[model samples]
Target: MRLELSTMRRVQRNPPCDHIIRLFEWFYTEDQVILIMERPPNSVTLFEFIKHSKGHPTERAAKVIVRQIIVALHHCNVCGVHHNHTHLRNILINRDTLQLKLIDFGGARLIAETPSEERTLGAVSRETAVRSGCECLYRVLCALIKGIPFWIRLSRECTDLLQELKNDRTWNTLENILDHAWFKEASTVNRGERN
Candidate 1:
């Protein structure tokens, strides 16, 4: 609860992205804290979305969703909010618009804070969560697009990034990952829209 409150306060001061789940208000008693949050109607978890889609989303659809997730992560990092749990289940998508909202901040932490042995809502560290989470999503995209196992057609870039993540040689920052060709193209579109 302390972590969630502190993180929300920081984000409230420097709002991250429209894609994040908005916390409207909170009240606390001696034993419990209740947060009133904005719930998107007719939403489903990314896990369910993928499952219902039969493990396939169109290339363009996947691109749109992935870009939004990347943008949200970039905002989090800039605000020093580390989403220590970034699995598909934590992401919600509208069935019609396909818009995304990242939820479940129970594992969130400040990046600058010193690491302690305390258990988070998830067991993974911040760095590991980001790397593994992004990699898994990327692989899922590949699997969906190609109709084959991801390992069968791992691109050089994917291989390199996965290797770096496994070896613990690189942090694979969201901004850096966004620099990849696919994401760079998406970023260009976003900038054009803003301009």
Candidate 2:
């Protein structure tokens, strides 16, 4: 609770952003702390959304969602907040507009508090995550593109890029991942925008 409060306070110092959940107010007692948070109507966890969507989203739909997640991460990083924990369960997505809000900062760390060596280790872990395509961003990618059986509905460019992430000697940074051609491909449709 204390960690979350500190992270929220750090973010509160920054300019307003649409990606992170807004913290309206907070207070604490001896035993408990209270946080007033913005609750978007008709929003559900990304975990629930994926489960309801039959275990995976279409590539185009996944791109939209991933894009927003990336934007949120970028915004948080710019605010010196490193969300050490990012997963489906931690993200809230609106069913109607497909807007996303990252939540649960209990394990968040400020960039300055993190040592340079640890950041390098994080890069190594990122490589491992990409190699397996099962952690970090690749987990979502594998699930979304490969479906339940972990195969099918994959495009050539995307496959190659995933392979690059796995086989490349040097690990790619998050920004580089965003710059990849696969992510830059023209959006074919906004399939996830539910009525």
Candidate 3:
């Protein structure tokens, strides 16, 4: 099945999560397919958001943004989908609510459809596919956090984890990195605070 079709199927089956872009409906004919989605009046792509900021997101903001992205990826994994493209351009943020929405599932693939080599441990699991996606995100986040094109002058925690991500032999999952001392410590402190 087409990636969009599979994505629609998985999304519709799951309970709504604010971090995922809502697909209202779709139309298909011999020539074209149309996806009607929810778009807030004032919103911009994450790329534009970052570019306009003209500065890196703070540690606090980065944590929140990363957490939301992780949540969205988790939902996709639970529904058996993998968002192959997890970059800034495909993500949107509501200017007012500051809510994140993952869009453009054209690159998304069902976990079951992925080639065996791409799957972690040569087996399919919700965590593996989603964590694989996180590999992309980790790089981006590190770059943003350090305001550099490469992971240089980053915190010790980020540097160590980034090394793990780069090591093919390393089995560190995205969930494992998220629960690392860096992010977990932040979560513990912000548990009761509201955005």
Candidate 4:
């Protein structure tokens, strides 16, 4: 498990996301692996924040958090990595600035050209159907927009994106996805609705 975590962490470092904690260093001791990670002051988990506030967050706050999460996911997918365990609990917020950061990549997997036949729930194999970057982007875009749970979402997206990537030559980039008109419209709509 520790080895898996370390691999995921390494993969995460390749394409760092502003919404993710920066992993600075790692070392192995006699019995434990020391992962030196950035420590954000006044940070709290999204679950904690929601709990303290009771149920959902304020509309303004939720929008901010959600946007940050989507940005993080976009980066991960674009980097050919899948963070298969994203949820409120995995999100951390800096209380002072209300900035969001994603934590825990234990479930992350590198996207590979050949999809592995090894099958298991919550397990990722390298074999993906999509062979093109654009198709992968489109699949990831759809997943982000849908707000699907991380575990089930990645597998589905991987299969779909692999197909799309093979067939489509054009795919949206993270910046474009973030700046898409649909997202802007959704943000506007969400902003208007109070928790």
Candidate 5:
């Protein structure tokens, strides 16, 4: 039943992550379910890139990838959805252009709204719920920038950011975070390293 629901949601939701492959069609047979999605051409996972190139990805390339991911995440959060298992492998890159698209939403969850009174320690303010989502975005970008292992990084960042969303004091919205000098500085550092 859970599988059935997941399959249905996959077809129905049309999640906004362009990096993620969208489910175009689905069917249920007597014994199983079949799902069809658009196949990316010459796709490579970020994990493969890290493995092949070792831990050092050019800072420029990393920033481009991270920026695209943040954009996608920003969109997802606006729609009240969160991908619980975002990681390097879930991001697919075009070999020619290095364009990134987030993929795989089997672990996505609809973010529940929290009451202002429920905001606890480490929690961002009610007005900053969007910023809490951005923190999640930052954690993933930071992990990639630092060359942290995908699985370990994703687990730690997701857990920590989710906690922060549930409890931070100075939380701002996603737009505010993106506008901050710190994010620009980090991105610039990454870009500089590429050169």
Candidate 6:
């Protein structure tokens, strides 16, 4: 079995975390490997979720979802799994419950051994792994809040944080991301609500 699948299996065996979708079963075949994953009910892609909300969902809603995303990535960091593909479409949100599930490990990697810098894939160090994950997280958050991609008028804190992420001013690691002031923004009102 590949590191990706084995890592997934290890995660599934550990304590349950709602942030990540569970992988029920997996087995290798001569040609291809088969993986059976859990499908969260009443869930839609974050892309669809944003579309239904019309551009951007309330900052509070986005914060909640983004926090969940951070938690999921943090979980991956602890498990030594790097989800290189952290895009809007890769996350699923329950329409009613507002729960989130980070899905699609197709581009995921296990951070067991340090690959040569020449290897063009997941980050090498744990910090860099989570940092890379956060990089993608911010990109997705940008699209989620901006309603398009690489854009936002959401909030000053959010704008600053996004800029810092791009500029590498802050740690850019997932832990620092969770501790960011923007991430701590309380859900008070939906400034971007539109009808």
lDDT of each: 0.65, 0.66, 0.66, 0.55, 0.55, 0.73
The residue-by-residue lDDT of candidate 6 on 1-195, one tens digit each, is: 375686676556567678998988788889778988888999999888877874446666667787898888888877767777788888999988789998887777766455563265544567667678767767876766675333424666667767877776646457667777777646233443552
Ranked candidates, highest lDDT first:
6, 3, 2, 1, 5, 4
lDDT of 4 at 193: 37
Error of 3 at 63 (Å): 1.0
Q: Whole-model lDDT for model 6 versus the true structure? A: 0.73
lDDT of 6 at 25: 77
- Candidate 1 ranges with C-alpha deviation above 4 Å: 113-172, 184-195
Summarize candidate 4's per-residue lDDT along 1-195 as a digit string, tens digits: 574455456546655678877778778788877777788888888666655653333334544555676677667655556666666677788876779887787766655434342343333432231222244344433433344333322333234433544566343443443453334543333322334
lDDT for residue 59 in candidate 4, whole number 0-100 = 33
- How do the residues 6-123 of candidate 2 rate in per-residue lDDT, one tens digit apiece? 8777776657567678899999999989999999889999888877865446666677777777667666655666777888888898987789888888877665433574575332
Tell me the spans in candidate 5 whose CA falls farther than 4 Å from its real position: 1-17, 54-56, 114-139, 146-171, 182-195
lDDT tens digits by residue: candidate 5, 1-195: 334336335434544456556667777888776777677888788777666664565445555676676666666555555555567787787766777777676666555566543344222333444544555555655555566433322233334433543464354445444454433643234222324
Q: How many residue pairs clash in each candidate at the backbone level?
A: 0, 0, 0, 6, 10, 0
How much is the lDDT of residue 2 in candidate 3?
57
Cα lDDT tens digits, model 3, 20-124, are 888887888888787888886588987787777653455556666777787787777767778778888888987656688888888776666445635653335
Q: Which residue pairs show backbone clashes in model 1? A: none
The model with the greater TM-score, 4 or 6, is 6
Maximum-TM-score candidate: 6
Best by lDDT: 6
| lDDT tens per residue, model 1, 45-130 | 98888778754455456667777777777677667677767777888999989899988788786764335532543333556546
The window of 10 residues in a row where model 1 has the poorest summed lDDT is 186-195
TM-score, one value per model: 0.70, 0.74, 0.74, 0.59, 0.61, 0.80
Look at candidate 3 and tell me the lDDT of residue 188: 34
**TM-score of model number 1:** 0.70
Candidate 3 residue 154 Cα shift, in angstroms, is 5.7
